[model samples]
Target: MDLSIRVIRSDEWEKARELRLAALRDPVAHLAFLDTYEAAVVRPDSFWQERTEGGSEDGPGTVRQFVAEAPDGRWLGTASVLVERAGAESFFADVPEGEQTHVVGVFVREEARGSGAIDALFEAAVEWSWSLAEPRVERVRLFVHAENARAQAVYRRLGFAPTGVRVALHGSEDAHEVEYEVLRPAA
Candidate 1:
């Protein structure tokens, strides 16, 4: 199906909420995302409303969410990027040495897998990161579950290389999240 990839608008919070809930229920959600469906489903509308608005185009501007939308207005998948600067206090892992963008909340509907939606979303995300003027992004990075080989393969194909850093998966003792990065192109 034909789709358009673009940053989500602040007023489209409902669509963002629905898409996020659907993503949390995917079969690979256990390995692909940090939040569980049960935890997310219980969140109040206000929470979703704020979360959606924060990632929208009109939000604080350090974060952005990109979605793949079908011509019929259905959202197929989504990805979000969080810009982290050195010495900043991050909600997850420690901020790396440079100003970089962390790719997160990535999800592509099963039906849309391998349809190029993922690539399009990431392209929009990385392009947007590179276009930032305040702190030039030095790299783009993302974490993948140790067992998520499918995602690792996709990241490799997209030119991201493992940075030899492994973070313990939240709430999991035996699992790890591998870090991968793509540096800014030489000018």
Candidate 2:
């Protein structure tokens, strides 16, 4: 089935929220997301409001979210990119003038995984990142659980290469996360 990829609007926050909750319920959610379903469920409307605004077309440059929607308007999957700057405190590291987009929260419904939903969502994100004019995004990156071979394979197929950086998992003494990067397409 064909799916369209686009940026979500503020008024459609509920759909975004619902898809997020569904993603949290996936079997590998523990490996894919940093937050738990219980934590998300209790977050107030204001939290959702801020999240929606931050990722919409008119929000700040720090973050953006892309979704794959079916013809009937149901969401198939989603992905978000966060712009990280040098010398700025990052969610996982401190960086020094170049801008990079960090891809996160990638998910496609089980039935939609092999179709084109994931690719479409990623293309949208990459397009948006490259479209930035000023602090031209230099690259797109994502971190994957070291144990998530499936995700790693998919990312590799999409042209991301391991950056050889490893971050220790916050609470898991034996686990680590690996970084992957894809250079920005030439103009």
By TM-score, the best candidate is 1
lDDT top scorer: 1
Candidate 2 minimal-lDDT segment of 10 residues: 89-98
Assess the local accuracy of residue 121 in candidate 2 as a C-alpha lDDT between 0 and 100.
Answer: 83
Residue-by-residue lDDT tens digits, candidate 2, 29-143: 8888888999998888888888988998777867888989888998999999988876788766655357888899899988888998988888888888888886788888899
lDDT of 2: 0.86
Tens digits of lDDT, candidate 1, 64-108 = 999999999999999999999988876557886789999999999
Q: Count the backbone clashes (under 3 Å) in each candidate.
A: 0, 3
Runs of candidate 2 with Cα error greater than 4 angstroms are: none
TM-score of each: 0.96, 0.95
Residue 10 alpha-carbon offset, candidate 2, angstroms: 0.7
User: What do the candidate models score in CA lDDT, each in turn?
Assistant: 0.90, 0.86
